[model samples]
Target chain A: MRLKGFRLLTIITALVLSNNLLAQSIDDVLNRGQVHGNFGMDMQYYQVDSLIGASETPDEDVLMNGFANFIYTNGSFSAGFRYESYMNALQGFPAQYKGNGIGYRFASYTNDDMTVTVGNYYEQFGNGLIFRTYEALGGLGYDNSMDGMRINYKLRDGLFVKGIIGTQRLYFEQGDGVLRGVDGELMVNDFFGGSLKNSKTKLTLGASFISKYQADQSSQYNLPENVGAYSGRFLLRHRKISFNGEYAYKINDPSADNGFIYKEGTAFYAETAYSTKGFGLTLSAKGNDNMSFRSDRAAGQQDLLINYLPALTRQHTYNLLATLYPYATQPNGEMAFQGELVYKLKKKSFLGGKYGTGILVNYSTIYNIDSTAVPTAENDSTRMGYTTNIFSVGDERYYDEINVEITKKFSKKLKGIFTYSNMVFNQAVIQGKNPKKYPDVYADIAVIDLTYKINKKNAIRTEIQGLFTQQDQQEWATILIEYSFSPHWFVAIMDQYNYGNTNKDVDGNFNERIHYYFASAGYVRGANRFQVGYGRQRAGIFCIGGICRTVPAANGLTLSITSSF
Target chain B: MKKLILLSILTTLSFTIFSQQEKRAMPSVNVTDMEGGTVNTSEFNNDGKPMIVNFWATWCSPCKRELNNIADVYDDWVEETGVKLIAISIDDARNAGKVAPYVNGKGWEYEVYIDSNQDLKRALNVNNVPHTFLLNGKGEIVWQHNSYQEGDEDTLYEAVKALAAGKELKH
Candidate 1:
């Protein structure tokens, strides 16, 4: 293994240096490089609020999380590093991020069709069924960048290959297990270079093999030190229709996720879509069984996850519908599907008014995979916990939801969007809590959003949202209003109320029913932004740009600053 | 390791201050178009016209408002300035397929694409969604802005019109 890696390093070095040979001079190369970066800082001052359960105050009074990235690129050569500091990290951030350090650094160069990177990098292979690495940074504080060497090369005009050998990042350090993977993809039409080269129908096929190796240190049950997984994927597209699918299978090598069960795991995902000028539709399906893949077996609750299974439900943005009963993917076992349709009502039609109206309908459902216990004399001495069929869905449902939205432009200065959603959330399963203690939550949500353009340099937006349920915080409503002063400043205020909370407090008073109000203003100048807000926060998952994080309930003053150069 | 990175950054900063000549070109990062076709960022162009590159996502409210507002005046902007607007979705695979539907549902006419893994986003140093950039006719990045407030498109339009008039933006 050592010799092979050395040879790969030598070849990559040669390819990288080949481009430098053609440069005019070293000074010329140095002069052409560019420096760019981005910086972000989030700070909060906590205040004790007995009403919202924010009783504990930090000893320092202020907590902050900050990071800055610096990248320099010169033609085919580029390098970058990220500096992160958490002065006793925020309330919800990972506790391990307590100090300042260079969290990420990488050196990469590309020559011709070959690119090589050493140090750290983020990559995804074929839907990330078996391998993916990324940094969510501020929101989740989740980063799994591989800290090692990676090489990507194009064998031909249509064939590409990438190989990586590294260990996953665990907070401030690297995980103990080592991961190795190689992937190849080929464009069928382009590779053939014949009748299908320019055909409307296009096809791409890919395959990847990834393996993780960890030393066995457990004295109880013998665990497989090496676990390998493979995935096959294809993309087929035509004029108005497209389909993509991937199937992954992994060898039996469990440590803790599945009670150390030795059952082989499998997952399959498929997505198809059709779109036209003013209409679009999509359908997606996923099946997974005992696919709890993690670099460290003992790690739990969003740690050391090597593979990813995207959630099939709609990503709601409204405060009530988004944070109350949001859906999260179950990595252990699930059968899920989603379908969505979007259509625009033509202008001049009865429902369109002067401007066209937009309509969106979406549905999603998730259920546990059917599994039956293996009847063994020694109580499953084989350790093959259960038998499962990919096609069979069990009676226990995880989540189900359907929603419809209508958007229309009432006039030149006014527009409104109304949405209604019905969902059944099995918190017992989705939250991994005791089933007997918690019942499934049934909710109906509604939201109305409006925006009025006061002028070219100012505007106002408002959102009224409500969520009604019989269980888990009975009923809730939220109202938000924001005003903008064009290219410079804006202000906003919001209030979330739990109006129908029947649960009583210790003094037989309905103290649980409360109002959480927050207000803030922001300023933007060129590439810099600064905002200050004071509010009461609830305990739930908040997502920003696809990254989700669980924030603890708190009452505080928050400040954020961001800039790029 | 931290010291090494700091040293390298300092050295690069000095080099930049000492010799700054060439304009920064678009990074060659591969992202998928809305139609699932691979497109390299280096090839992004508008046939000698100014281009507006906007980064957005489905779940981001401000991003949606910005794009929807742009759609209202897109035809006028295009006919008057001959500018091309490119909207890039920074959504992950979870919502990749929903992009086209959402855009079409709103009847937006901008060129749409997907950066599922955020390769181009990272290369462009986009810290958050609603980050907008303007490129000249030669496809060289000239002006950039982060985040958005309603009516911010007017400022973006001013930049586009200036670029179309063959003027350099102070940004």
Candidate 2:
């Protein structure tokens, strides 16, 4: 195996050396370039509480997570780097993110129709089915920025091409696999601008090919050294109607996630939307079969993932609905479908008052892909572990949800939002829970959010939410109130109570009814903001495909500061 | 590695300290329009008038509120100060398709674009949604603010008016 050094994402750009710069003094030259960056820091102080299993806390007591980025851009050249430090990272973050250094940096130059970059960067191909790399939110502690060289150019008026040769970043180190990829796109209307450019119909076509190379060191099986994937996508639009779809396929490569199965992977997604003034309708579908593609086959759980598979579902923002039964996309194999309708009732009409009312109806579901195991008789002849019928949904259901929301302006100074959701969460399937330990959760959630304007700079907002379910923790109710002193300050308080507890503890006793409470205040001025809070519950965790981490019950004071310049 | 990083940092510092005075300009970055066409941030123009660049998303409640609130008086803002608002949605590909329809459903008469990969968001150093920046006629970012409350857009409008009147904004 070959070892490659130099893992940096910052751009060390080549400054301009034109004769025009020689005439200017140092101050003049330096003052021409602009510098911009942002800083964010999160620190939490913990208090031990034995009730919710927080009896012991870290010796550090106060854990901090922070980062700052500095970028300077002048004309066509830009260079920047990010500095990250996690003094014992915040709770529920990926364990790998210890003390961070420079996570991302890049230098790039764009001239004429071409641009070149060396160092760390993020890139994505059509729909990111074939290849994609990016950094998650700071608190997520997930980043897969690439360290390499990327060149993008406009081949013609409507034709564009890009190529990347790099390796994925894994924590502070680089992945074992080397990656190379190329992408090309064509705009039909722009390419042939005679009549097509002015026509109401618009069309775009694109294709991407990516391959990864890794050394074979396994003694158990002969692994493929080079694994490649390719995809094609197109978008068509005519007036108010738009349609787009992408299909990707990868060569057979045995990996740990698939039990070393030699089944080739295929995935495809398609969506169509029709929208007009005050009304929008959309439907989308996707099928994934062994679509998990990672730089290092040995890596596990979001490590070195080279592609993104979006779970076709509504990302609820409400507290109970978002945290409780959210469905994660099953990458290995799943068939998902979603449809939504967003419409606004006309003013002075039924259900609409002086101001119009906004209505949203959404339904989404996911099911396992149908697959049949290969006969043991011919298993070794061709090690294709199983065969799947494309888009064929299996009998087992993974997740299903239907929700509706109504936003209305009741009076001149009063507004309200009401939402209701009915979900059938396959806890045993989606969360990989034992059937005996947890049953399928059938839940109904309702939320009422209201805001009243007391004056120009003063307003009050309230939220009343309830979740009723027979499985997992029973029923819960919550209430929140916020006071806003506009242009500067805001204070809010919230309390969540587990009213109905039907589940038994490990000691065969009833679980404690913990009324998780929190209070916070914040001040914002210009581009800087300061927030201080006392909380007793952790935020929601993102569990992509049933892989979830337990968010410890927290009791602490939190301080967060953010600034941009 | 540490030495190399340190050296690179020094070079950038020197460039920034000497190159430009205190003028902050929008970085040139590419984002996709609703029509799948790539639009460069540097190409944003409003006929030599002040422009409001707002970074928002569909899932953010405060962002939705701010945009909706502005929509009610957008025509007045234009007539009074000729300020053009460009709402940039940072929705990833998963919800990119819903952006156009969602924007229309809400009846917001503002220029909208999708930063599907957050290229523009990162370039502008935006920490969270509702992060907004005001640019003068010359395209220099003059003032910026983040987060939103019920009446926050009023404060933003005041700055836009000041910028339109060629008044120095108190940052």
Candidate 3:
């Protein structure tokens, strides 16, 4: 810990000295540099209850997590660092994130057409099929930033190139593997100068190659020390229509997530859309086969994920629909499709009344990809584990969802939105549960959200939602009411009730029906906000962008403060 | 314990020194537009008019609600004050393809840009979405806010009006 403190001091001193030197040399040209930052902290006090499965309580009554980022930018040069403290990280966050340190720091500068950055950085290649490093610090606690150097150069007006070499961050330390990648993109029309710049149609093409090097440590199987993956992408747009597609292929590599199979991986993603005036339509499809690309072969569960496979299902906002059966992307092998249509009725029409009415309909589904296991000896360790063809969908149904939403304005002071959804979730496959332990779930959900403006300074919004199902906790209802008083203060209350739990206990009695309730009040002034709340949080899978983490149940008082300048 | 105390002191000192400097200009970072073209944020100018830059994502409920509220009164805001609202979506590659269609579906009139890699977001030190920045006619960031609530647009419009009228903003 002392060494960590010294390291942080050195970094800060170096940054300050560099900024001072640059300011002195470019006094007139650059002027005084600007410093901006944001700070956030979340503190929670816990209580234990065994009835609702929130039995484990921390030894420490209260847990706190905090972070602050400070950035200084002057002309073409900039530097920043993030300080994080997890005095015993809160529930649902990795326990490894306990303590205070400089988790991220970087320095970068740009001169004309070239830019260079050193230290910590986050980057993504085409569609993130091959390489991506990012942080989803919201409800999801996944931060895989790379500690390395990156360079980007603009060869001309239409062409751009980027190169990066780094080691991925694993907890507080760097990963064992070294990562390297390069990407280039060109806009065809822009490359032709101003000749077709004004044309209604445009075309852009890009390609990327990434590789990771790690020492082979397996005693039984001869694992590849270096694994490479390459991808190509294209985007074509013509007036109201647009199409985007990317295809990636990875060389044969054995990894723990893939059962140590030496099978090559591949993925394809394509989407097209057409839009005009008040109507829009989109269709997308994706297929993945043995495409679990990770920096470390032994890393499992959300660790060292070097790529992203997006879930094609619609992301619901209603609490019940979002929590009950949200689908997670299966990176190993899956085929999915999604289609959506959005339309608006013209104002002054019968259905539209004084304001236009909006409508959205969406449908999506996912299925396992066809694969035949390669026959091998029972004890044989070195063998190809599977054979599969691209786009060959299997018989197992993974997930399906259909939903519709309508928005209408009843009066100048009142507006309402109604939504309905039906979902079929395969719990055994997606949730990684025993097939005999949990049954597949089918559910229907409906929601009504209404907002009423009271005079000019105060407004009230309410949401009433219900989810009906026969399996897994049965029926549920939620209600939320929020009152906002213009630019300063707001208060809200939410209650979620699981009214139907039909399963009987050992005594032949129904399980306990629980009500999770929470209330919050916030004060906002310019760029700072302070909020406090007390609530009973139910245990569930909290997800963001298809990545999920199991959040434990608890009854607690929570306080959050955020500020940015 | 001694090391921790020393670290805290150093951190406080650094922040004090850094904050004493003058306000900084927006960093020049390259972002992608809806048409798949690269655009440098330093070149962002609205013809000598105030611009409201909003950072949002498709998945954030408050962000969608705020933008929708602004969309309802955007035309009048533009006519009253020659202010242009630029919406920058921080959607990553996972949902970047849905942004254009989503915007059109809602019939938003603001100029939308994609910050897929969050370059501009990090450069601006924006911690969360629904963060709005008010840039004066000269493209200097005068005021900014994090998060949103109902009727927040009214306060934002007031700032734009003040900038247009050459008056100091109260907030």
TM-score per prediction, in order, is 0.92, 0.92, 0.92
Indicate the worst ten consecutive residues by lDDT in candidate 3 chain A: A542-551
Write the residue-wise lDDT of candidate 2 on A1-565 in tens digits: 1223222322222222321243245555566677889998888898887756777677779988889999988778899999988898877666577897888889999999899999998889989997988886455667888899999898777888999999999987899999999999999999988988888899999999999999999877778899999999999999999999999999986787777777899999999999898999989999989988999999887689999998899987676887778788888899999998999999898777789999999999989988998765433424788899867999878889999999989886899989999998988877888988888888999999998989999999888999999888889888888888888898888787888876567998767777778787889898898877787765663111001121333478978788899
The models' CA-based lDDT, in order, is: 0.84, 0.83, 0.83
Evaluate residue A151 in candidate 2 and report its C-alpha lDDT on the 0 to 100 scale: 92
Model 1 lDDT per residue over B80-102, tens place: 99999999998887888788777
- List the candidate 2 regions with Cα displacement exceeding 4 Å: A1-28, A375-382, A504-509, A541-554, B1-22
lDDT of 1: 0.84
Q: Which is the winner by DockQ between candidate 1 and candidate 3?
A: 1
lDDT of 2 by residue, B1-171 (tens): 567556655665566555547577677788888777888899999988999999888777778888988998999999999999999998887888888889888888999999988889899998877788999988889988888888888999999988888899888
Alpha carbon lDDT of residue A250, candidate 2? 94
Order of models, best lDDT first: 1, 2, 3
Candidate 1 lDDT, tens digit per residue, A319-411? 788777889888879999999999989888998779888888999999999999875543343678889997799999999999999988998
Instruction: After the best TM-score superposition of candidate 1, give how far the Cα of residue A473 lies from its true spot, in angstroms.
Output: 0.7
Question: For this target, which candidate reaches the highest TM-score against the unseen true structure?
Answer: 1
Question: What TM-score does model 2 achieve against the real structure?
Answer: 0.92
List of clashing residue pairs for candidate 1: none
Question: Which residue pairs does candidate 3 place in steric collision?
Answer: none
Q: Each prediction's DockQ?
A: 0.36, 0.39, 0.33
Docking class of 3: acceptable
Tens digits of per-residue lDDT, candidate 3, A17-100, equal: 765555455553434677788888878898786666667878999998888999887777889999988887888777888789
Q: What C-alpha RMSD separates each model from the true structure?
A: 8.4, 8.8, 8.2
